[model samples]
Target: MPLEIAIAGGGVGGMAAAIALQNQGHNVTIFEQARAFGRIGADVNLTPNAVHALDGLGIGDRLRATAARPEFRISRTWDSGEETSRLPMSAAAEVKYGAPQLTIHRADLLAALESALLPDTLHFGARVAGVSQTEDGVTLTFADGSTGDYDLVIGADGIHSAIRHALYGADDPQFTGLVSYRGVFVRGEAPDLPNLDSFTKWWGPTSDLQIVTFPLNRGEEVFVFATTGQKDWTEEGWTLSGDIDELRDIYKDFHPEARALLDACTEVTRSALHVRAPMPRWSEGRVVLLGDAAHPMVPFMAQGACMASEDAVVLGCALEGVEAEGLPAALERFAESRIPRTTRVQEGSLANDWLKKGGNADWVYGYDAWGALKYEVV
Candidate 1:
C-alpha cells in the first residue's frame, strides 16, 4: 500500500526523506517555507556515513563528481600555528568505512537532492503553520491558512521547527554557547589563501573558532566556515550579514594562511548555535518528526544531514510490509531504530565542542552511516 505523506521543510533532510519515500512507491508532498531552495551556507563535510546514504539514493557518483575528496584533515593552534595532529581521511577512510568523506557546497548538494525529486512534488513558500492527527490520518495547516490531510505527516523542519513546537511543546532550544560565522570565497581570487583541498580546523582556548574550506560546483566556488562566540546570536535566516573585520580581529593570532583565509572571505553570515536534548518521542499518532525536528544536535560532528538521510531510508524500510494496524508499529520501530544511534551522534557532536578542535579526530571522522544502517536494520 502506498502512503500519502506530507513533509514539512524541503531542506537536505526533508528532500532526502521525500526522495526515499517516493522511491519506495509512496506519495510524498514536501512543503518548504522558503520561496526557493538555495541555502546560503558554506561547505558541508559529508562523511563516508553520509556518502553511503547518498549511494542508496543513486546520486553518490554525482555527488562525488561535484565534491572534493580531501586527502587529510588536520588541526592547528590559533596563536602558535602549530600542527597538533592530522587524520589522513582520504588515504585510510575508505578502507575503514567503505566510503570517502566529501566536502561540497550546500547549494550544489541541495540541488542534487532536489533534482532527484519528482516534478512539482516540492511546494516552496508553503510554511507549515500547524499539524494535527486523528485516528485515520494527519492534517497539515499552512501559514497561508490552507489545510490538507494525509496518511502521514513528517516534520523535517529545521531547528526552531514549527512542527516540533506544535508536537512536542514550546521549550526553547538550548544555546550551546557557540556562534558560527560562515562565508564563501573564490580560489583564484584569494591567491594568498591556504590550500583548502583538505578540511582543516584551528582550535583556541576559551572562545573557540574554526575555518573549513572546500570546492563546489566544479571548483568554481569555495565554501568557508568561521565559528566563534556570539553573545547576541539571533533567529535570523542564513543571509544575515556578518562582519569580516570582526572575524579577522578574532583570528588575528591564527596561522598566516588561516588569517588570509578569513581576510579573503567576502560573503559572511553569522548565527547562534543551538543544541537540543534527545526528544522523549519522535512520533505521535500519524504525525512524526524527522531530521532536526526530532534530533537537532551541535554541528561539531557534522552528522545532522547524515542522520536525516538515515532517517528517510529507515522510515521507508519500516513502512514496508505493514498493514493499517502496523502503521503505528512501523513508526514505533522507526523511532526505536533511530533514537539510540542519533543519540550517539548527538552526544558525540556535543563532546566535540569541548575537545580541542585542531586535534586529529579519526574516531569522529571514521564512521560508516551505510554500514550502521545495515546493522540497525538487520
Candidate 2:
C-alpha cells in the first residue's frame, strides 16, 4: 500500500513537501489554517541552495523566468553613504556553487507550486489543532473539530506549529529583537536610480536596513523589502500591517539612492522576526517535523524556505522503505541527517543577521549552498 501522509501547513514548505512526496508516488494531503496561501513580501532572494532545491522539484526555470538575477550584492554604510563591499553575484556564485542565486515575488513562486498540486489534495481553512501518534499510525484533530488518520504525519506548518506543540509542548518563539517593514515599488516611479540589478543593504549600529529589488512579471513590476530592528516591536505574525511613516523615519539617514527607494514605498507590511532555539529532537515515533516547524530561523540568511525544501526531500528519501517494517527508524534517520545541518544554518543565520546589523559583509554573500551540500553531506 502507498504511504498515506497528512501534511500540516500549506505555506511554501508544506506545498514543496507535497510535491516531493507526490512525485515519489505517495499520497499526500496538506492542511492549511489560512483561508488562502500566498506570500506577502515584495521579493525574496533564493540563494544557490534554494535554487538547487527548487531544481530538484523541476521548477527552477519557471522561477528564474519570473526572477531578477542580481549582478552583485551591494552594501553601504548607513551614516557615511559609502560602499562597503560589492560582491559579484553571477561569476562568483556560479563558479563557486554551481547555481546562481535568484530573486522573485513570493506570490509567483507560490502560484507555481500550487499549480502542480493534484485537485482536492490541499484542504484550506483546516487548521490542525493537535496530532497524536500510536504504534500503527498518526491521528490529526483540526480546529474545525474534524479528525483524520494517516500512516505518516508531517508538521510543515511553520514556526508556531500546533502539531509541534502536540508532539512536544507549547512554548514561546524566541524574539529576535527586530522588526521588519516591507513594501514594493515601481521602477518607473523612482527615477535616476542606478537600476544596478543587485540587492542593497544599509548597515547601522544595533540596527540594519536591507532592500531586495527585483523585476517581476516580465520586468513589469519591481518588488522591494525594507527591514529594521525595533527594540520595542514584538509581534510574531509575519503578515501584520506596518506603518509607513515609521519606516521612513527609520531609514532617514540612508544615502540618497537608498532614501529615494524608501520614499517610494507606501503601505508597507510589518512583523516582528522570531527565532527558535534548537530542539533536541525533531521526531517522535511515526510523526516527524519539516521546514519552519522543525527549525525556524531569522530571515537574515534567507534559508528558511530552502531548508524546508531540503527537509521534505530528505525525509521522503529516508522513509522510502518504512511500509515493510515501521517508521521509527526512518524518522530517527531523518532527524539525524537534518538536525546537525539545520542547527548549523540556524546559528549561521542568527550570526549573519547580527553582522549585517553591524555592517559586516565580508562573509555574508560568500556562501555556496550547493558546495556545502556536496562537501558537508556524504
lDDT per prediction? Answer: 0.76, 0.73
Q: For candidate 1, write residues 216-312 as lDDT tens digits.
A: 5555666677788656655756667888897888888777877877777775887777888987688887777889889998777778887888787
Question: In model 2, which runs have C-alpha deviations exceeding 4 angstroms?
Answer: 38-42, 208-220, 232-236, 353-378
TM-score of each: 0.90, 0.88
Q: How much is 189 displaced in model 2, in angstroms?
A: 2.0
What is candidate 2's lDDT per residue for 1-378, written digit by digit as tens?
679999999877888878877877889999988788555653667766677666777787788778777767676666676766666665577676656777778788887778777788898889899999778888999887889999889898888899899999987788777777777766677756775466666665444566545545555555666677657754546678888887778777766777777777777777778888988799888788988898999876667877876776677666655582468777887788778878988998887643343453323334432233344342
- lDDT for model 2 comes to 0.73
Give the best candidate by TM-score. Answer: 1
- Let me know the TM-score candidate 1 reaches against the reference structure: 0.90
Count of clashing pairs, candidate 2 = 0
- Candidate 1 lDDT (Cα, 0 to 1): 0.76
Candidate 1 clashing pairs, residues 3+ apart or interchain:
49-369, 75-358
Provide the RMSD of all predictions against the true structure, rounded to 1 decimal.
2.6, 3.3
- lDDT winner: 1
